[model samples]
Target: MVMKVLFAGTPEVALPSLELLAGDREHFEVVSVLTRPDAPSGRGRRLMPSPVKEAALRLGLPVLESDPSDPSFPDVVKATGARYAAVVAYGRILRQPVLDALEGGWYNLHFSLLPQWRGAAPVQRSIWSGDTVTGATVFRLTKGMDEGPILSQSTVEIGPDENAGQLLDRLAQDGSRLLAASLEAVGEGRARLVPQSPGAYEVARKITGEDAHIRFDVPAFAADRQIRACTPEPGAWCLLHAEGGRDDTGLVLHVLRARPLPADDRAAPRDLPAGRLARTKRQVWVGTKSNPLELLEVKPAGKKAMKAADWARGARLADDAWCG
Candidate 1:
């Protein structure tokens, strides 16, 4: 007996899971897709459909546009008569009515391990926290936010130089497979739900432009985390003094990659007077508080991203310029 399934997701992460459902069409039917309303984009500000909604349309499935908090959402899902609902990166909370509408239960594909990082921005939070290992979880959805019972999980080792965007892409692929297996378990009556243990949980709050500023006074390692966390979105940048001793300019310096320098080599730019450009043949290292950040790649304001070595060669970086 095939189980009718309703898939609700938004964003690139949701695409892989949707593909998995499409592949296993024999066991599940994606009755309809629920996505956020279209929004204006690009320089022209033309309205654009979401990737999820577009995929749903290509598959000839009905696409519903409604806020999760709207009174009509539960009714829409109920009309589908789907036995199960798969929620992934949906960007909206599922109320009790939507959860109860499913015959079996609502399963969520979360980017982080259950009970750990459960909230708005799991992937970004995990990278910022410097977790050596992180993974995805398929859990039985509950009234609480990501505070549901876990069914299965798969771990991914964090690479030394991986950023939030890169790591999230990998996690999304893993999550697709994991979600498929979890659905199989549910179909076969072998689904096991594990409730989260009571303790302090780290919430993944939405990152803001204010959160992306790199503070030079902080330890270089701390600054490195913020740089990785805000990549491909609100970039992490340091304020730099433009030429002619004019007012300070907001230089959008994107740290493409970096690593913690040796303890003995750590030097704060303030320790020296100012305007310092510490460099090496391969990479130009920037001194912050306590430690030095080896800038593997950087994008200066109004410029294309280039290697630190290239930037160092082209720009006349004073030995004390980087100090500020």
Candidate 2:
């Protein structure tokens, strides 16, 4: 018999899994979908529905909007009589009543391995912490955050300079397929549960405005890592000396792309000051505590993104102008 599936999710990260399940109408019936309530967004502050709601509407499926703690949530979910529920980036934790309704119980699609980066912001935290690897986890939900027992797991390599946004996009695509496979395994009663290893785990704290500030005095490689971790959300930037001598104010610029200096890149200064700009015909390099970052693209405040070298041409960045 086809399984009745209830999907709870919000945001683009959840769309792929929803789409995958929705597409398999013969094997899986998406009885209901739960998404966050419409909220104001963009410069105009227009109300916008969550991505999952948008997709559910496209498929002509039932959609509900409410917080997880709402009194009506369990009744609404129980109305569907779904055997299983798939939760991905739902933005709210599941309470016990909703958990007990599903015969097959609820499963989550988390971006990192279980017991690691369990809370929100896993991808961002992994990149910021300089981890060389991260992956996706499928687990049965319990009450203890992401501490659930895993049904399946897959490993993904962290690219050299990938930020949270880029990594999320990649994982979404991978998770689209992985989640479907996992659910299929569980349905066939062939899935195996694995216990996570102890002590290598870390939590991804939510990103804040303070985390976006670029500290030029830090090592170039470390600074680059920060840029990669926060990009496209809270962009990584620093204060530089602008023309007309405005007392060296903060010049926020979004880092679009960056590359690390090679071990033999002897041209950089040993004690190069933070926020100092170096340029060549092809690229613009910025000084950190050690080495330099070759900035391929940047977006200065109130301007479109441009090549760092192009920005350097109009703005003369003095070598002595270091970040204070």
Give one clash count per candidate, in the order shown: 8, 0
- Poorest lDDT segment (10 consecutive residues) of candidate 1: 267-276
lDDT of the candidates, in the order given = 0.79, 0.80
lDDT of 1 by residue, 1-324 (tens): 576788888787799998789768777788778888898988999999989988888888888887778788778788987888888988877789878877889999999987899998888899899898999999999888898899999999987777888999999998999998899889889999898888998899989888877666667777678788888667766655433243556355666666666677544223422223466566676666666777777788779899878877877665545534
Best by lDDT: 2
Q: Which parts of model 2 are misplaced by more than 4 Å? A: 195-200, 244-248, 266-271, 316-319, 322-324
Local accuracy of candidate 2 as per-residue lDDT tens digits, 230-265: 887777776666542546565666777787787577
- How many times do residue backbones clash in model 2? 0
Q: Candidate 1, residue 261: CA error in Å?
A: 2.2
Q: After superposition, how far is residue 225 of candidate 2 from its true place, in Å?
A: 0.9
Candidate 2 displacement at residue 272 in angstroms: 2.1
- Estimate the TM-score for candidate 1: 0.90
